[model samples]
Target chain A: MKLLTYFFQWLMSLLWVVALQAQAQPTQPYSYPPSEVVRIHSKILNEERKVYVHCPKVDSADGNKRFPVVYVLDGDNHFELLAQYIDYLSRPDVLAIPKIIVIGISNTKRTRDLTPTNSLLNYEGKPDSSSYQGSGGNEHFLQFMATELMPMIDKNYKTAPYKIFAGHSFGGLSSLNCLLTHPDLFDAYIAVSPSLWWDKEYLLKMTDEKLKHGSALNKMLFFSDGNEGGRNSFFHKSLVKLEATLAKKKLKRLDYRYKHYPTETHMTEPVVAYFDALRFIFKDWEKQR
Target chain B: MKLLTYFFQWLMSLLWVVALQAQAQPTQPYSYPPSEVVRIHSKILNEERKVYVHCPKVDSADGNKRFPVVYVLDGDNHFELLAQYIDYLSRPDVLAIPKIIVIGISNTKRTRDLTPTNSLLNYEGKPDSSSYQGSGGNEHFLQFMATELMPMIDKNYKTAPYKIFAGHSFGGLSSLNCLLTHPDLFDAYIAVSPSLWWDKEYLLKMTDEKLKHGSALNKMLFFSDGNEGGRNSFFHKSLVKLEATLAKKKLKRLDYRYKHYPTETHMTEPVVAYFDALRFIFKDWEKQR
Candidate 1:
């Protein structure tokens, strides 16, 4: 009887230790979430660019799945924002949008690569020669993306043909410029308060000339401006004109939306703009999926 | 004549090489943009938390100056979004708000900490026993934040007393719960589509009893709901009840606002909600500053 009692006490103590271990070790850090950074060499730009890539938590069931890619310019500025949105929106519970691969392209040269025309003009149309000296190399930048960057990204990652090009300010101009010059590069374009006034409203004029009259240009475009001035401001006027130009063309299969954020500033526009852009681009996608 | 020509050619070639080197270097990778990750050990949760912190490009002109901190919940979700906004909005050109530090708190046990009550009831008022078995620990969670999390954050990072607590969904519920229970913890509270239906409107009952009628709370609360179940859904009804409760009280010094987004869904609300929440919270801050 004494031996049996001692053995029972030992068994109870062993169970307590096991219970404590289970309580303390809730979950392993590896099981939490995973995010990675990928680097690609761009021969057009002649530089090795680092991209912050955040993918959804892949389950074992869906091992061999491809995802739509959102290539956001100014990776340093908005990579994390896009990553967060994609993560939350594509959660198993949310199911607002499908899981996506967010590739944030950090900027190397803002003025040189993102602007449409080479000009020394600043926001006020004044020659800020020092700041704007190396402007208007966006075409080369797009070439870099088309021939070198995208191919490298495609070769490395599990990417679907469907891609999104997004940017803000000068970056925004680059996004629109890419769409106009190389429309096949991406499925959708998001220009958040694009600098249309760059090089004497070069892209704004280009928009009017690019689209064929009443012809099909199957793409989704979302453009917006925050309160750069008021509703009557040049910033607002430019976006309105872009909208009006698209409306006049009435191009078949061209889906576009222009939003005016009276409350947000030019700087704060991307936060809301990117969100709306994603929603706009994927509006039909959700229904179809 | 041959000697002189050869010397001139050598000089020109040297000058050409120097110019090429100057242009190719790429402006020292813009050293002013200092964004880095800081890992700190948290005693509260007993884990090392990796916080992605972004400070304003610290101007050498402003020596040893500190800025206000915005403690964003769901750090993994909205840290980058808020960081980008702060960086852009506080630019010399934009100047909408002062440069602020963003502290993104990544989650460990999100459901355990963020939810207010320990109930098995899901959103549909159905018991999901396995999913919510360890629920209703938000009070203890808040205590952990007050005693352990905040101090650790304040100690490691350059923080000011002026703090803002921002969250969405379960995080949103936690934010409101913090406001109601520990009003002194954060100066402003932002709850974007908070789970007020948690534990059969546990927070709704607590809000009425905690906040005295016509009393000075001296706090800022921003709450909003998207098209959760249309306008007449239980989610919408709870928010309306919350608004009505506060209205009936007429609490002095409690600056609050409720926004409704009919176009946005529960998943997509945070994008627009956060933007509007920041605008509302800081509406008077600009004038005051």
Candidate 2:
């Protein structure tokens, strides 16, 4: 009986040592592709703006090459996501998209800067006191991008003329607003599940009013909707209406594609939507030719 | 004319100064989710191996929580990709998948470690003098994972028993090989565009021989193919054959899914395949349940 107790005590001591060793092993952080946070003082917004920038590695053969820039909103959520996608898709083996700079615009006042019109109405068109109180400062946000942010980026990075504006949800609503108001700001636009229900479809109305039928607007556009509420939800209906409106315009030189993802939720749709949107925008990017 | 020349020279001097200022801006690296590289000596493989590990942040409420692990092949290509996906999917709002540790197994010898057979033939059933030499070390590789690497991970990290094995191309072939030879090793498996034409459909034939008809083999399998050659390419046909072979067996309790991406290339397919595979694997996970 005494020997048995001694064996048990020895086992406990070994266990304690093993456990301590496990905790003591040294670990170092893994390296990721180099990206940077660029804090720019925006006069239009009257505050300092922080943007995450991811530039592709300089090609040894052509060190002076310039790259296209993709300025994505809701940077805190989707900047790293886009940066990862661009890095993988633009690899020499993949070449699905070209090497480009990704500029993620982190938000300070999210609802204020993303919404186009001031209203307390939520997704259901019901007044929500807490959510949309300080909304509708998108015009100033665009000005900040155009005059302050864009000039700062152009003045610094090896950037090409081709630019893409991408966003999700309220950010998506602002993307459409930018397309309608400042059409030439970006060569392409991506709106992933834009909240067309905002202000009783404010951007939808503006898109129809601003775009002329049979007019040439040489740009690429990719928009998508996820199963937000259901098949008969306003989200689906709004996207269908947007597609119909675009089709009815018959605008020359406008290359556009609309995709509906029924299996994905609003939160999960960005994973696939951004990828498909990249494919649609770069459909003409034939590698090695 | 003299005044115009003097003005042009002054403008040139100002532009040079501005360019120099642009070049002088120092940007710091953006912070990503902390991941680590762990090196272990593998007795089975007779070499040292390095694996990248990404763990979820410890919840303040439950600091001692353990996580499911996903051991993915081709660490050089897909380690960061899976890490990013897991981080995004397991966010507070998204919560599509449970917080899990991602272990990316980096390759020392691509062909030797991933291939199941020693044949020196290429994808086209032709002998390639440049590639596929000194192959057929997958069994040893699995032994390494089972004995050395897995024990190291489980000993050092807070790990649960629910493991997943994910791979692409040759790595995918090895994934299937593991599923066949050691079905109990992983709870789930993801084979993205598996090279089924390896060694004259050896694994395909092995799958038919090994899995009993109408037997209970509870596992989640996700396999896919891209537009490698064409509609009737060997890559497509081989995947079709594997799907058919699995269906023919009528394997009971085997939750399997097959996807074909006609628009995606072999190299670009993993971008979407990995995302889709994760969704399929975690389809039943309800948020806030």
- Please tell me which predicted candidate would have the highest TM-score against the true structure: 2
Expressed as tens digits, the lDDT of each residue in B143-196 for candidate 1 is 777887678667765677888899988999999999988899999999999999
* Candidate 2 chain B least-lDDT 10 residues: B1-10
Q: Which parts of model 2 are misplaced by more than 4 Å?
A: A1-26, B1-26
Leading candidate by lDDT: 2
Q: Per-residue CA lDDT of candidate 2, range A199-237, in tens?
A: 999888888999999999999999999889888998899
Provide the clashing-pair count of each candidate structure.
3, 0
Model 1 lDDT tens row, A135-205: 88999988988888778678777888899999999988999999899999998999999988887788888
Each model's interface RMSD (Å)?
17.7, 16.2
For the second chain of model 1, what is the TM-score against the true structure's chain B? 0.85
TM-score of candidate 2 against the unseen true structure = 0.91
Query: Can you tell me the CAPRI class of model 1?
Result: incorrect
Model 2 per-residue lDDT tens digits across residues B1-289: 5655675688899999988987786565799999998888887887888999999987796578899999999998998888888999889898889898999998899899999989988888899857988999999999999888888899988999999999999999999999999999999999999999999999998999999999989999999999999889999999999899999999898899999999999988998999999989988875435
| Candidate 1 off by > 4 Å | A1-57, A121-131, B1-137, B155-157, B199-202, B286-289
lDDT of each: 0.82, 0.91
